[model samples]
Target: GAGVSQTPSNKVTEKGKYVELRCDPISGHTALYWYRQSLGQGPEFLIYFQGTGAADDSGLPNDRFFAVRPEGSVSTLKIQRTERGDSAVYLCASSVQGARRTEAFFGQGTRLTVV
Candidate 1:
């Protein structure tokens, strides 16, 4: 079974530009999540999709961030007007069916640098 995978292991962009981060979850997994990890901090949950719908998106910082899981397999996180403050490692995770004590497997992540 393929594990989670992310694109653009490193992304460099000027402030105010838009960037899209991609995530491919493991096959047969029904739960997918997106998180942001700042230096020295734990990964903060951004959004979660159960199958094809966003089960929880309250963690999304603001309107600047958005995500979509159309086919229940892959997900994409979009950030508008990138900022230096937004610079961090974007992580994607996947689980089996529920979050009940089930750990999520994370990707290598995309290290976005807004310069």
Candidate 2:
């Protein structure tokens, strides 16, 4: 019954700092996704997880971005050496099953501001 949840609704960090954003998906959902949204723009797909494995990680801009869902439930997005350009709203979503047809519910998002 619960929806996707993201922590630290807002984050402020220096250009070279590291940041870890957390997400908790709905119960029994088999598919999870991460997206980034810039000012006035649509959310961009980042990585997707089906069960405990990453199904698609191509959207990650570079090696500095990564995510993990070890036990197939909660996931964490890790950014190494954060840049000012990395500032954006990080959103998480989950679906009842892994399919293009199923609807995915989104979290409020963690807004990261790199100074």
TM-score of each: 0.95, 0.98
Q: Write the per-residue lDDT of candidate 2 for residues 15-99, one digit (tens) a residue.
A: 9999999999999998999999999999999999999999999999999999999999999999999999999999999998888
As a TM-score, model 1 comes out at 0.95
Model 2 alpha-carbon miss at residue 69, Å: 0.2
Q: Against the true structure, what is every candidate's RMSD?
A: 1.0, 0.8
* Candidate number with greatest TM-score: 2
Q: Find the number of clashing residue pairs for candidate 2.
A: 0
How far does residue 26 in candidate 2 sit from its true spot (Å)? 0.7
Give candidate 2 regions above 4 Å deviation: none
For candidate 1, lDDT tens digit of each residue in 3-69?
8999989999999999999999988889999999999999999999999999999999999999999
